[model samples]
Target: MAFELPPPLAELRTRVRAFVDDAVIPAEKAILEEDREKKRDTLNALRERTRAEGLFVPHLPKEHGGLGLGIMGMCALFREMGRSPVGAACFNCDAPDQGNMDLLLKAAAPAVRERWLAPLARGEITSGFAMTEPAPGAGADPSNLKTRATKVDGGWLIDGHKWYTTGGGDASFLIVMARTSDDPRTGATMFVVDRQADGVEHVRDVPVMSPPILQHREAELRFNSVRIGDDAVLGGVGEGFRLAQARLVPARLTHCMRWLGWADRALHMCREYVLTRESFGKTLAHHQMIQKKIADAVSGIHAGNLMTIHCASMLEQGLDKEARPYSSMAKNHVARLLCQILDDAIQMHGSLGYSEDMPFSLWYRFARSARIADGPDEVHDVVVARDFLRGALTTLV
Candidate 1:
């Protein structure tokens, strides 16, 4: 264990755990049922329930209808809610939106916040963080960013290509990342563009391995001279990379936590099945190979959990530079750990796991993307090496 939770947080974890097990997990049936209308109804009801219990939007500040829990506090809530496929969304604390809200709270102007962030906080609208561009443009490395935001009279004219912009297909608005200059460090800027703005086009929703749920939907969008007013600027000009770090650093850690919970769910399912299913002369759980797999996964989860907690504490303390090494280490570790755990579960389940009739197949689809999303495991490893060489050694907790 890295550190002990305060008494209040410990108790809160218990309550939220109960809520997830007793309520949210049950709602996952709407997914298998394949009833969109029923799913929406169930989600709306659960949203109200989470709000009533003071668990909704746990990442946002108290004034924005969140718990003001800071980074460390929302961790417990996110882990528990992540048990179900639909869990975190019900509470309005899922990614892209969650990360977007974090940037908005810290950077958006008051009027801009009222017009955009306010409705988004209440879930009246959805937004996509459009930073990843197609190949030959920005993907893992922002230095390759090619989308240009040319300064025009009274505002900026944005022309770009973005793919895998999660939630873009149905989002009411988008936060776009565009290069403003040739200087690599201060070349980028972020702007809020309305979905209905002229010259903005949603090409299509890119099919992914996971189910076609709105949350997992990746999309392609084009800005053909789409114009945005000066008011839409988030943070400041030439501050895009800085502002993005503020969002991505914490976001990558939070993603680690939620996936940690989901991995635990997979392990639980594997354990239950192995104990009941006989192999050779005994149940599969008694097999030495099976025991070894379980042992490795349990230890890996613990290590990842502690790493996430340690990095989270650094963020809470405002040790931004100090947190980067640890954050990179945790994201890479957790992303790889998730895939191995899911693979082990699938191997243990044998034919049942490989089949679509089981949850492992779906879970694997989700876990497989962990390596690529946020930032690829390869990129994080590079970051770890570069930071260590730069003598950024204070963050090795």
Candidate 2:
């Protein structure tokens, strides 16, 4: 019955909108203009302003100097932030960092927190979560993990190769998944390896479509006899799988929520173009086909937003097990839908959307990877189907 946000949340959304329009949008233009060398500098300057506005780290707890907002509130803020691709990154709520921060807060030791989490929370240094590996490694299957952490005097020695490590190149610390027990029956365990540690090498930065990134630096990590203390274990031995899942659920939801705003912004751009651009004797908006496309774009965005909000609300209520199925559905659905919506918006823009002069083309490029990046749409679909069969589906449906 109550579909509208509460008064405080409504006010928060308005403020977020204003901040994004007045601040984030302008910064995006500057980012688009900057060369690869200058983008990081421009981004840092913009982030300083976001920090001053107290808009950074909305999901972090209050004790850690965050807004300490609930999931619904975070979803609202993230959607607004996602309106600009740089907004989430600027506010220190971007992926890898967002997920990394959540892990530290939830399960990391206080000593580990002192060494790494505090700096991360303050946005002083970057971090990465390395789970995916190349072929013959852990790609898409935790059970296929080939990375091994052999027991040795004082610490564990790590040896393996990883790719698509989203922020690995810039990360001061990496949460790595490796096999500690020899049975090969138990899933891989996770360890926190400092970036400067011996045998940890940054192969190279894999170029991606997103811009203004300090760590589009998804690199290949080679660990040959890399060492860390027994304290390096995150959570507990054999518990890495659980910890990884915990971090991923919220991470995927946040991604879906943020990208929904990006798609909304793209749709708005398409709508404005249609209303202004003339075709034959009339504006593009006058065409029935254009109207249908615009309608679908809006509908897709609404559906994605609804799914994200529902998941967020459930999470705030601590209904997480019930929420996981929805999170996967949302991540998979929204990621794919976002790509579709962006494609439609591009079609609506004609050649302009496909051109590098506009962010539309870049968004189209970035959108394609979303489905694959977060556990692929196929994986989420399987989870959803299994849940549906188990009769565990919830109000998020």
| Top-scoring candidate (TM-score) | 1
Clashing pairs in 2: none
Off by over 4 Å in 1: 32-39, 394-396
List RMSD in Å for every model shown. Answer: 1.8, 2.0
Candidate 1, 1-397: lDDT as tens digits: 3466789888888888898898888877774464333246777788888889988887788888987887788777678877776778888888779998888888887777778888888877889989999989999998899889999999999998999998887888888999999988998988888989999899998888876564667889999999889988888898899988888999999888888888888889988998999988899999999999999999999998888888988888899878987888999988888889889988998998899777777777867888998889899999999988888854433
Query: For model 1, how big is the CA root-mean-square deviation?
Result: 1.8
- Candidate 1 local distance difference test against the native: 0.85
Distance from true location, Cα of 364 in model 2, Å: 1.2
| Model 1 residue 204 distance off true place after TM-score fit, in angstroms | 0.5
Q: In candidate 2, how many clashes are counted?
A: 0
Cα RMSD for predicted model 2 = 2.0
Highest lDDT against the true fold, candidate = 1
